[model samples]
Target: MGMEHSILVRVITTIMPALVRKEIQDETDRITGKSKQISPIPIHLSIFSTNDIAQTPYYDFLILPVVNLTLIDLPGLTNVAVEGQPESVVKDIEKMVRTYIDKPNSIILAISPANQDIATSDAMKLSREVDPSGERTFGVLTKLDLMDKGTNALDVLEGRAYRLQHPWVGIVNRSQADINKNTGLSFARRREREYFATSPDYGHLASKMGSEYLAKLLSQHLESVIKAKIPGIILLINKGIDEMESELDHLGRPVAVDAGAQLYTILELCRAFDRIYKEHLDGGRPGGDRIYGVFDNQLPAALRKLPFDMHLSLQNVKKIVSEADGYQPHLIAPEQGYRRLIDGSLKYFRGPAEASVDEVNRVLKALVMESIRETEAMVSG
Candidate 1:
C-alpha cells in the first residue's frame, strides 16, 4: 500500500501542477507516519570535491545534480503486449523501455510540449495489442529519466553525455521573427482602414446604410417564417432595432456604417433562429440522437406511449444497459420533453443570457470606438 500510494501520487504530480502538492504530502504522511523534513545533503554529494569545477560557467548549472528524481513502481505485468504482435506480452522491463523510447526523434525532453505529444503517440502505439484473454491491459512503469540542459542538473553536470540536444539549431528564433512580421502587417492593415478608408463622414454613412438593410431583412424574414407567431422571436427583432436607434442617438458618433454592419448581423441571426426552430419542430433529424424513441419497438406497449423517449433523452444510457429491455428513465417529466430545444439553441448561440438587440449593438459600437481611439493614439503618440 505504501509503494502503491507513493507511485500514484509521485509520478502523476511530477507532470501536473502543484495544485495537488498539499494533498499528496498529507496522503504520504498519513501512510508513512513521517512528517516531511528538508535535507541538508551536500549539493555535490556524488563528488568528493566541488573545487575542481568551481570556476567553470557550467558549475552554476551543476549545483544540484539529479534534483527532481521520481520512481514509479509497477507491481506486476498483467495486460502487456508488443506492437504488430497481439499475443506477445512484454515481461521484460528493458525491452519495454527500449521499444517505447527508441524511435525517430525519440529523445524525450523532461519539460516540453513535445513530451505530451510523444507520450500520447507511444500510448497509441502500445494500445494496438491486447492481453492473452482478449482483454485490454496496460500498465505504467516506475522509472523516468528527465534530462535537459535548461532544467536538468544531471544534464548540465554531465554535458553532452546526458543532454539530448535539438536536431536543428536556432529554429525557434526564426519562428519568432516570422510571427512578429505577421503581427506588424496585420496592425498596418487595420490602421489604413481607420485613417484613410473610413474617416468620420464616410464611416457614419456606411453605418446607417448597413443598419437599415439588416433591420429591414430581419422584420421581413420573421413575418414570413415562424407561421404561428413566436413572441420571443418578435421581441428579439424589435429589441435589435431599438439598440441600433440608441447607438445613432449618441452625439458625434463615428463609423456609423460599422454600427449598421453589427445590427445587420443580429437581423441575420433572427432569420437563422426562425429557420432552425421550424426544422426542429418539423422532426428534422438532430445530430447524434440521444432521444431513444427510435428503439421504442423493444419497449412494452403500455410504456411506449409515454411521450418522452428517456433513453434518447439522457446521455450515457445506452452504455449502462445491456439490452433495450433494461431501459428506464430515472426521472420522467412531461414538460421536460421540449427542454432540449431551449438548451440546444442556447448552446448554439454561444451568447449571453441577456442577448438583447440594444446590448449587442452597444457592444459593437464600443468595440469600433475603441479601435478608432487606439489607431489615433498610435499615429499621434
Candidate 2:
C-alpha cells in the first residue's frame, strides 16, 4: 500500500501540479440557481459577484494504483488577499486549518520552502498553537536548492532550529524548468541525490536529507500512530458485534419460505403479540415493564451521560455565584445564582426526557418488528 519514491514523484508530476483554481459566483446566487458555476446546462447570471464566500467544495482524485497516504490539501496559508480575492479569505483559511489541526487525532504536516522565512511559517505557527509539544506535528523543508546565496538550512535539517518531535527532512525537488522540460521523477530523484551528495554544506548529511528519507519517516510515523489506536478501534468493533448478536438473538429464528407456512406464521405472530398486549393492559411483565423502565431506567441512563458534574464543578459553581453577586459577596445563598443554576440544570433534563421518549418508541417499534418477521420477506421484496 506504500508508494515508492519514484511512483510518488510520478503521481506528483502528473496530478499535483501548481493547484488548480476555479471561477465561482457568490453562494447565495449559487444555491438559488441564479448562477451555474459549472453545470451540465450553462446558465450565466448577470448579478453574479466575482468573490464567492458561501460554499467551499472538496476536490477528490482517484488514482488506479493506491498508496497508504491519504492527503488533505487545505488552502495554502496566506497573510493577505491578493488582488480581487475577498478580504475574509485569510481568516477563513486560518479558521479551516485550526478546525482540522485542533482535533486530537489529526497529524499536522507543516511544510515550508527554504526560501520562505521559517520564523513566519503560518502552518508551523498554527500547528504549534494546537499542539504546543509538537507531538503530532511533522515538519517538511522543501526547495533547499532555492535558499539565498551563502545560506544553508544546516540547523533546521539537523533539528537544532525550530525543533519538532519529528525532525524536518529537507527536499530538493525538481525546479519549474525541469518540469517544463518533461523530466521523469526517477531522473529528478537522481539529481536530488547528486545535489545533496555534492554540496559541501549538505554532503555529510545526505543520508538524513532528501525526498526518500521524508517518505520513509512519514510512513513510520503513520504506522506508529495507527498501531497505538488499534486496541481502541478493536474494542469498539467487538462491542458493535456483540450488540448486533444480542439483537439477533432477541429477534429469534427466521420464518419459513413456503407461502402457506408464512401465512400461518403471520396469524400465530399476530396472536402472540395480541396476547402480550392484553397482558400489558392487565399490568403484566413483557410490555408493561418496559413502559415503567422509561422513567426508572432510561431516564437515569440518559442523565448519567450528560456532563452535569462538569458543568456544576466547584470552580464553575463558585464562578457562577461570583458573577451573580456582581462585586458584592452574599451572606446567605446568592438567590440569583441559585435561580440561574436551577434554570441551567433544568434545560439539561430536556435532552434526557426526549431520549426517554425515543427509547420507548424504539422498544415499541422493536416489539412490533419481532412480532411481524413473517412479513419481512414480502416487505423486503
Candidate 3:
C-alpha cells in the first residue's frame, strides 16, 4: 500500500487547510488501526480554507469566507502498458483525464517528479492536450530532494524548458522509507519545510515550495476564476428565463376547470351570437353598413306573407287620392286597366326590393360567422 498511501497523503496534504488538517490526521489514524476493515472508504477529501482580509482584537473577517476544495484521485498515467495490465487500461486512464479536464471552468494541477524531465512527462502532456494555452494548468514539481547529485529543476521552475503561464512550485514528497518507518505526517511536513529552507538549490524557492504554499496558490486561482465567470453565469441564467417565457406564451394560460365550465363558456358565446342575429335580422341594422357581397339564398317565406292583392290596391288608391287633378271618375275600373297598372308597379319595384333584402341577410350572416370564429378561439384557449 506504499503507492496508495503516498497518493492519499499528497492529495490530503495539499487540499486540507491548516485548521482542518488535524481532523484528517485523526481520521487516518483511526482507519489504519486494528479495525481497518470498518473504516469508511474515502472517495475524495473535502478541505475548507479561509483567508482573512481584515483582523481586529475580537475576531477576523474572511475575504473568501469559506472555500471548499475537493480533490479526486484518479489512476496514474503510464506511457507503456504494464505486463499484467491490458493496453486498454492505459488508454482508459488517458480518456478519463481528457474528459475531466475538458470541462469549461476546470483547472488542472499537473504533478511531476523533479528527477524526470517535465517536457516528456505524461501528466504534463495530458494537461497540454486539454488546456492548449496553459492558462488553466499549474505545475507542481515533487520529490525535489530525490534529484540526482548536481541535477536540479531550476530551469523547469523558471520555465526555460517548458513555458507555463504559472511558475512551477517545488515540493519534497515523503519517501517509501518514511512510510515503512511509519513516520508521522507532521514530522514529514517539517522535514519537507527544512529540506527547502536548508538546501542551496531549492533554498531560493523556500517561500513558493511545500503543500501549504501550494494550497494558498490554488485557493487564489480558484477565487480569480469564480470572479471572472460571475457575469457570464448571470447572462446564461437570464437567457434561460427569456426562453422559458416565450415557451409559456405559446402554451397560453390554463382555464379549463370542469365539463360544466366548458359548457357554460360555449353557451355564453352562443348568447352573444343570438344578440347579433336579432339586431341585424329583425331590426334591419345592416351590420356595419358594409353592403358588398353575393347572396344565393332566396328571401324567407315570412317576408312573402304580406297580403299582396289588398296591400297593392290600397297603395294604388292612396296614390290616386294624392295625385287627383279635379274630378274622380275612374271609379268604373276595367280588369286590364288595373292589371296594367299593378304589373308596371311590380316591374319597377321587385328587383330593388329583393336586392336590398339579400344584401341585409348577407351582412347579418357575416356577423354571425365572425362571432362563431371568436368562440372557437376562446374554447381552444
lDDT agreement with native, every candidate: 0.35, 0.71, 0.68
Ranked by lDDT, top first: 2, 3, 1
Candidate 3, 138-239: lDDT as tens digits: 998898887899999999987888889987888886788876666677888898899989989888889988987888898899889889898999999999
Instruction: List residue ranges in candidate 3 displaced over 4 A.
Output: 1-70, 180-182, 242-381
For each candidate, what TM-score against the reference? 0.13, 0.54, 0.54
For residues 1-381, write the lDDT of model 2, one tens digit per residue. 111211222232334222211122232244334521122222221222223323335634332434444455556778887765667767867876777779898889898888877898888888989999999998988888888889998888788778888888888888889877767778888999999999998999898788888888878988998999999999999999999988766665666799999999778666766765556535653666787789898788888888889779999888887899897888887998888888889899998898888888887777666545534433333
Candidate 1, clashing residue pairs? 72-142, 206-257, 207-256, 207-257, 211-260, 290-312, 291-312, 292-312
| Cα error of candidate 2 at position 216, Å | 1.8
Candidate 1 shows a clash count of: 8
* Model 3 steric clash pairs: none
lDDT of candidate 2 vs native? 0.71
Q: Ten consecutive residues with minimal summed lDDT in candidate 1?
A: 165-174
- TM-score (C-alpha) between model 3 and the true structure: 0.54
Which has the higher lDDT value, candidate number 1 or candidate number 3?
A: 3
Q: Which stretches of candidate 2 lie over 4 Å from their true place?
A: 1-69, 267-381
